[model samples]
Target chain A: MIDEWYPVGLFSQLDPAGRQTALMGEPITVGRDAEGNTRVTGGNGRTLPVRLRYGHVWSSLGEPKKELFAIPEADQPGRRFVDVGVVRVRCSPLRAVENFLDVAHFPFVHTDILGAEPHTEVQNYKVEIREDVDEVWATQVKFYQPQAAKSASGGITTEYMYRVPAPTCSVLYKTCPPRPSEWDVITLFVQPLAEDLCDVWPWMALFDDTTSLTDLIHFQQTIFLQDRSILENQIPCLLPLDPGMEIPTRADLTSVAYRRWLKRHNYTYGAQLVAQ
Target chain B: MHSDTTGSWTPVALSADLPAGTVMPVQIPAGSLALWRTDSGHTAASADRCPHRGMRLSHGFVRGEALSCIYHGWSYAQAGNCLRIPAHPGLVPPETIRVVTHMVEEADGVIWVALGRPEGRPPGLEGLVPLRSLTALANIDAIAAAAGGKTSPQGIVEVASGTGTICLLLSRQDEDRTLIHVLLKGITDQAARIAAVRSTESLRRKAEDIHKKEFAQ
Candidate 1:
């Protein structure tokens, strides 16, 4: 496992004692070091180190440059360091955001409000980040016409970025898009709970408006909760247990890529991964 | 300053602010309140302290018709009576064991909690709808001073903006702060509502700055 740093939120901005519960029912607390590095405490006392980061991420491509370094192997030799934390993932690089484009499931999964074809698909295009793993996501939109002026109705186009070992992700959604031609993306890093379970958190490039941020979050949360009920109830929750049933269709390409990516990276399980 | 002001009721929040099935912490000249609205849309304000084990009731979550404490999960009804003690499911809680409740009333979108046995019902702003409630870092006096007005006989400092005049219902949260309920005139434009939100935030910042500066002196 590489100690590749995936930028989440700023260490200084987040309170050490502040605790917020995720839609996954996992409560995470964030603390900052004197040097302004973030240490997120999850479930038990499990803490993950975080560094503030932002580089030329083409909202279109979502990749930062890679650099190499070395370190010493403990008890084996002298200073044998390794290439440290550098993220090169596409925007919204997790299932939580990728599955969001599954417009058909909205009606059956979340029956209350969001339904099938809530809005028309504005665009369906893909961009590849220059990494070992390829990534993609579709963007759809529902603009409030002059008639429904009260709501901040715009479009949401999310992209999914995939990075290896770090298994880090980026979830980017821009309003009134054609996403940002330059930059401005709400980046997120998805941490795996189990093989199937994952927690998506915000990155340095945060959602711009507070109210819009809350609304988008709650909407996504409602959808995530909708997915949780079905995913948790599924018999073979994890993929490795039943790879025998690797049936595929044209639309299942993304899911296939995700499964392949998980396999290529040493599949993480239980408390062992956190110690790294 | 004597803790309780006579016949004055601070607006803990507007009726629409709490929403159905939610509980929030609010404060007044008297003390803090665990303000909540039930599933049925009725509002209630009780002492922030839970009767069982003195947990902060505001930290409790609202479910159905009852609000349950975060600690021991002691549930209480809108009337402040202990309804269910989860650990003692078989035993019904006695009527004697109950939280100290306060008189709460909602009139014309504003929800008012009495300091003692206050005057008449909360003043009827007949045509105003509640926009939202926010905590401001200023005392009622400081808010009034910032607004260049006095706390109205009805306990509010009116900040008339280009966006249909926002009435600041100031409740002294503690020593140096007040909870301001930003309200808009009913039938105002959606644009006006947006402006109201912006206007109130600016007003709060000014009032808070005044309060803090004066305190330093």
Candidate 2:
């Protein structure tokens, strides 16, 4: 977990006075150097590796074997890259990613907007851990949403593909309402301040051309704020790796697969190893 | 007051404070509880977690007679049994999918939660009526000092006021905090009630100030 890259703040919104943040419980300061490059320094006066990508500043405590994951849609033409700001929640970072991977909660947690009553069924989806890239992917996931996006006019059965390229980060590819042929890329990059605390940075690459930037940001923030209550109040405050700890239904395929992958990689940070 | 071996009850909240169809979080020696009342005025205290997903049931809403989780709308009955799962409407939740519930007794306009297998009933406050409950940043000792009285074996502190005698029902909320339910004795008029409220507020300020001084020392 220490060797992984985590987003601390959006590059465009970094404080010139140096924003104080933490990574894996270690306090760090994010500021810009004289050359206008992003600089991340640890509490012990050690300079950490900084990578400015996906409109956010990334940092790592240990040396990362691989570079940051790629989102090709970010560089595509006519795509609006939105930095949805950060929301600090008192929950395990892994739990935040697992909640993002869940589609069944749309009907309840995000009622009327993401989903509504009578359409709570989560269809069968395919979940696999790609050995080459060492990431968990769930494809062909479909859910009935009332307002799937800012530009959505009415209810639509949204098709989604979720990917967990990093331990604390998840990228969602959902059917774009305006351009059904293309997918709207939404990502949740979590910064683990402690085992039971996280700062979620939600970014989006969308094809919508009508909605204003403030409206688009508010739409995303409203959806995530609705999820914040659930994330904070979950009992145990840690992601349980033990299957017996939490019961899962057929709709929880992505969560089940994600937990298995985390256990396989020995990613126990912010994870409860045994049932309490 | 009963012996510890026979178990004891904790005054969680005033019955008037927890209205029908609402849920609130309360604490006891065992842990936290989701104190809720059904729409029909039936009250129950359950473990503050949804059995399915561990979401705090206190954050959930009460629908008709069941407490529905805000996360997935999994409703649980006041008896702690799973009543419905909105995600899978057709499936009746298994008997194993039930939250743990504690015994609750509402007496003298106060809600008491049993910690274990408590005996007898909560102590009766025969003539006094609860005015309001407030949480103080000070402990029981500081509160008693502020009121110029000592706590009785039943956790009641009596303060002689200009209008009437003020009765404080004390419950230790945490190490440094106390939950105070202020009751009035021989006071019924609106003017007396207002004076009691003002006096209680002044007592709380003094108690908190004393607590801060002790901590500083």
Per-candidate clashes, comma-separated: 17, 0
Which residues of candidate 1, in runs, are more than 4 Å off?
Answer: A1-276, B1-6
DockQ, Cα level, model 1: 0.01
lDDT of each residue in A1-276, candidate 2, tens digit only: 789899998899776678998999899999988887778999898999999999999999999989999988989999999999999999999999999998888888888999999898777789999999888999999889999998998999999999999999999999998887999999999999999999999999999999999999999999999999899899889998997667777788889889999999888889999899
Tell me the lDDT of candidate 2: 0.90
Minimum summed lDDT over a 10-residue window in model 1 chain B is located at: B1-10
Candidate 1 local lDDT, A1-276, one digit each (tens) = 223333333333466564343212345555555775455555666664433433211110122233311111112222111111222221223344334433323333554344322332222333323254333433332321221111224323323322222344544443322224422334434544334555445432322333353455455455456554443332223333124332222333444454455445553331122211
Assess the local accuracy of residue B100 in candidate 2 as a C-alpha lDDT between 0 and 100. 91
Compose the digit string of candidate 2's lDDT tens values, residues B39-133: 99999999998877788888889989999888888889988999987767678888888889999999889999988878778888889899999
Q: List iRMS for all predictions.
A: 22.1, 1.3
In candidate 2 the C-alpha lDDT for residue B77 amounts to 93
Query: What DockQ does each prediction reach against the true complex?
Result: 0.01, 0.62
Candidate whose DockQ is highest = 2
Model 2 C-alpha RMSD vs. true structure (Å) is 2.0
Write the residue-wise lDDT of candidate 1 on B1-217 in tens digits.
1124456566777776688989988876655679998888878888886654345678777889888765445678888888865433455777876777888888888787877776566667777677888888777777888888877766767776774567776666777767777766552888778877887788788888988888634
